[model samples]
Target: MWGVRSGSLVRRRQLARTLRELRVHAGLTIEAAAPLLDFSPSKLSRIENAHQGVDVHVVRSMLDPFDVGGDRWSEILELTREASAKGWWRAYGLDDRGYIPLEAEASTIRDFTVTYVPGLLQTTDYIRALFDASFRRRSEATRERDVTVRKIRQERLTSAERPLELLAVIEEAVLHRPVGGPAVMRAQLARLVEAAALDTVTVQVLPTDVGAHAGIDGAFTVLSFEGLGEPDMGYVEHPMGSTHVEKEEDVTQARLVFDHLRTVAYSPAESVSVIERVAAQM
Candidate 1:
């Protein structure tokens, strides 16, 4: 999961410490705690590691095992409340945990991609084609659910507030490859042409002739906010999971790399011509 937001790592650590202390004070090992909660020992371990959260019910049950009283009960209740207050991503789906809320909250998104086309600009046919590639291993119901969720996620790009400013630097090859075949590629490029006209959107293509560029590291998004206290954050995804980096040093380094990439990439007009050229070839 991307690192915790709103709450600090310190708070998570404190909660873990409190859990451990309660367990020890009650003269129980995690093995002893597991049966009472009807959970595995690993479940308790994961909760303590901050890999999972403890709901109010579980916290109440855990407290029952210990002999704590007075303000302690309410304090633990408050902590659990903070932990369980549906993270911003909850509106879409309980399982999406894709950092979508974090991305939506961001004011600007600078993206660089070289593999499949980025999600925001994907046509339904293109998206279905990409989903089908992965659905070979999934059940039909699961595949349908995945496709539906992706379409909902894509809607954020045009939401009423117009909160996000998206600047994409994509490789020429992405536009050239026909995901759902030639006809689908043509429609996808045409959709791109329309999306590029949005006031908050900018598209640039990194041509093959550019030789080399900084984005070769991998696809990444740099999310910046608009406020006195907000800091820029960088997100990187892998097949296994995603990472969110918000430290000043990391954001600064990614900004420098992206700045260099923007310089080497074709201008927006040139990038549109490149797309037209690829579409014509298809």
Candidate 2:
């Protein structure tokens, strides 16, 4: 929670953990704590699970009963304020599927994509083309907003203070497929090559020749945070919706898949060579 700011999923999770621990230390069950704070059991549960935000007033109310005072009380209250603040993504009208907040706080991002470039490495033209090809047609404004959000998210890669380390494994077939026509694909591939030059970024390609692999299921991202005492998080997106995996076991499994992919995929240097070759073809 030290580095986590307002509207961060990490902050929410930290707050939730602290609150739950406090309640446990106070010997109060969720049932008992809910009424004391004038919150429904379900509402309290959501807050403790990081699914909902708590106001500073409510945080104080909840902590008072547990004899939490002084700096500890002040810190929790400040976190509450930050937790309830609106995130930058909200301004774009994007739904908080919980990924962005986590991404913002992640120290390392490991992504494996089967069909397209990872959003973080995608060019604006590629994003536009992908959206255009989607079955669910969105308004122009919505599409632009989505692109803007992605552009903002990409800033984490170049952040001077604490840049995020990105390890991306892309399917070889993805390079062959034309996302936004030859021109767009060429530009996107060039972008990939450029990004690969960054010290923080590592791009690898999973050759199509290696048929039937562990990543055949779908694409997933694993976000690792700095010293927050929180476990690694796994994220999966599909046609229906996105899923965030927090359980240690599941995250570890995802990590295993990613590790396997790295072994099977081309090395970073080879991957860049492949990308450059593909761009020439395009």
Candidate 3:
């Protein structure tokens, strides 16, 4: 059996892809593989879909029938172990940790926000104020945990190993909205200006004057991975829960919408100017 080790969400996703391909290459369906592995079809399906993790023993069992061995088999076993390991966010006790892992693993992130600032670009004070105003009341401890999580998420932007490339387009109205009052907004705008200066980050503003735009519908983020052989993921957050869109067609549509928003939004230089002007007003 493969040895157990720390698993990352990215590895889980990669393992899912490899397992599905192996099954196809072996000319077996989920129905056939399930009985052979003594797994329920749904359980096997979930593993292939990356909705759950697979043990090293199970991975070896599934691959054994396929006559898959050598480096490919070893690689999959390692991924199996890594996929079972918990991410840092899991310790936070937050209910919905779906998006952070994807964000952490993404090589490129494209975001469009119609309301307040994107979480990745938000300031500490701005995050506090937004949390306070949220309808679902949270304890101070919970709020602090939330803030810590956001701060940790921002580390990827400045990571020495693999800095994240962020392309963020925000609505002009967001700049005008007073989330944390003048001082907070000023600081937040300043942070945006500074972040925009970074080589890995780009900030653009969608002027309110551009009425009836493609992004008028709502906000979303598209996360692209680095050589993971996984499809780009699309995330849509609503009042109830978030939706992760994985279908190629849906992901393509989200990408197109982001692309259109990019074309309509102000240039980065103009955006920094607008941010500075807003900060001066505050």
Q: What's each prediction's TM-score?
A: 0.67, 0.89, 0.90
Give the top-scoring candidate (lDDT): 2
Number of clashes in model 3? 2
Tens-digit lDDT string for candidate 1 (167-255): 89898888888899999989999888888888778998888788767778788889876641356888898877789887899888898
All candidates: CA RMSD (Å): 7.9, 2.6, 3.4
Looking at candidate 1, the ten consecutive residues that score lowest on lDDT are 1-10
Per-residue lDDT, model 2, residue 65, is 83
Better of 1 and 3 by TM-score: 3
Q: Give the Cα-based TM-score of candidate 1 against the true structure.
A: 0.67
In the range 1-282, model 3's lDDT, one tens digit per residue, is 012223556677788888988999999999998899898999989998879877999899998877799998898887787777766777887432488877766789999998999898899999999999988798999999999999988987887776889999999999999898988998999999999999999999999999999988899999998777767989999988899888999899999999999999999999999999998987
lDDT of 2 at 225: 87
In model 2, the Cα lDDT at residue 227 comes to 75
Which residue pairs in model 1 clash with each other?
Answer: none
Residue 244 shift from truth in candidate 2, angstroms: 2.7
Whole-model Cα lDDT of every candidate shown, in order: 0.75, 0.88, 0.86
> What is candidate 2's CA lDDT for residue 112?
95
